[model samples]
Target: MDVVVGRVAKAHGIRGELAVDVRTDSPEARFALGSVLAAKLRDGTSRDLTVAAARYHSGRLLVRFEEVLTRDVAELLRGTLLLGSTDALPPTDDPDEFYDHQLEGLAAELADGTRIGTVKEIVHGPGGELLVLVREDGSEALVPFVRQIVPTVDVAGGRVVVDPPEGLLDAD
Candidate 1:
């Protein structure tokens, strides 16, 4: 499985440096020097890009790939999705921690085991992580992925126990 680690936001300066919007929690490891990432371009083709240099500037990650050496080349890479193989990822040591892929497609239910939905995906934003659920009615619900709301996650059992507050799962 290929997981998105970053997206090319734009070309930076006159060099081949690219400003990237990080999607992975471990950006340092994912964008480290010598790391090779699969770039899924807008044209549906994929290419391997080797990280030549990387740096943090003003809270954004700037990366220069070995295959790119000019601003024009970097500009062409804008909006490219940088992917890393899931097999290269190390398992999380913390019991409470989980990869987005692990939570997706799991059965979402209440504490009483009443099935409500299936986890569609995990949305990571500035506020926090949200559990996007595809409800029984085909509508979607965004549940905050905090310990208070999602009290239980049984990856092996293939389910998540959601303890949502009133009106949280209500249809508009």
Candidate 2:
């Protein structure tokens, strides 16, 4: 699995620098200096870029790629999606923590082992993250990704045990 770490927001300076809107929780680890990254374009094109420099200005991240040396070249990557392979991703220090990519596609089941659906996506919002499950009926169920509701995430087992309140799944 390849996770989206950031996106090229806009060209920053004439020196080929660009501003990136970070999507990962650990920017320092994901966007490490001198690290090479994979960029995916909208037209199904892929490119490898090396991080020439990375820094935080104000709140957002400012990055410079070795391949992008001019504003025009940087402008061409404005909407490019930055990706990081899970194979190279180091495990988190916290045992219970899991990345979004890891949670995706896991089977969602009730506490009694009754299967509900497969987790399709994880949506972030003001409250928190919601697990989007594609049910067998071709419908979708939004299950909150909180620890209380989702008590167990067995990544190796390829399943998540959800203890949702009554009517939440039926209503969906």
Candidate 3:
């Protein structure tokens, strides 16, 4: 399966260029020209495309895909998600570390096995990143992404043991 890296925000001009909201810091490495992309359309349909050109402009990624030569067609591709297959991805080469994909479905727990919630989202915050915990009432808690706060992650067990700061869990 391909991991999502960015979303096509809108068409740049009448040149088939698309403005992308990037989710990865290494945009140049990932969205370079001639690279292949497995994109998910707005309707949840997926397709394979080849990147013809790409450049950074005004903090947005301007990209052109092969066969997407018209602004109208590019407009229609708005809100599409660009992804890369896991098999094509280079190894992380990090031990005792986890990627966002590994953290997605892990259950949030306390030291004593007290369940807090489920990992719903991993959002990049101003200070760092935050782990969103979805509760039964549809409410959620934004747990700080820190080693001390989130000490353990058991992907096989499908849970994460968190040691939240004082009043952090109570706020939710």
Model 1, 1-172: lDDT tens per residue? 9888899999999989999998777788889899999999999999999999999999889999999999999999999999998788789999999987788899999999999999998877789999999999999999999999999999999999999999999889
Q: Estimate each model's TM-score.
A: 0.88, 0.78, 0.81
Task: Report how far off residue 128 is in candidate 2 (Å).
Answer: 4.3
* Per-residue alpha-carbon lDDT of candidate 3 for residues 1-172, written as tens digits (9 for 90 to 100): 7667688999998899999887653567678878888888988798887899998898677999996899999998999999976565565666555666667778899999988889986775448778989965668899997889998878888998999878897752
Report the lDDT of model 1 for residue 109. 99
Better of 2 and 3 by lDDT: 2
Q: Which stretches of candidate 1 lie over 4 Å from their true place?
A: none
**Which is the winner by TM-score between candidate 2 and candidate 3?**
3
47 Cα displacement, candidate 1 (Å): 0.6
Q: Once superposed on the true structure, which residue ranges of model 2 sit more than 4 Å away at CA?
A: 57-59, 123-128, 137-142, 166-172
Task: Judge candidate 2 against the unseen true structure and give its global Cα lDDT, from 0 to 1.
Answer: 0.87
Worst 10 residues of 2 by lDDT: 120-129
What is candidate 2's lDDT per residue for 1-172, written digit by digit as tens?
7788899999998989989988666678777877878999868799999998999886778999889999999999989999987777777888688888888889999999999899987776558789999998879999898899999999999999999988889852
Model 1 scores a TM of 0.88
TM-score preference between candidates 1 and 2, better one: 1
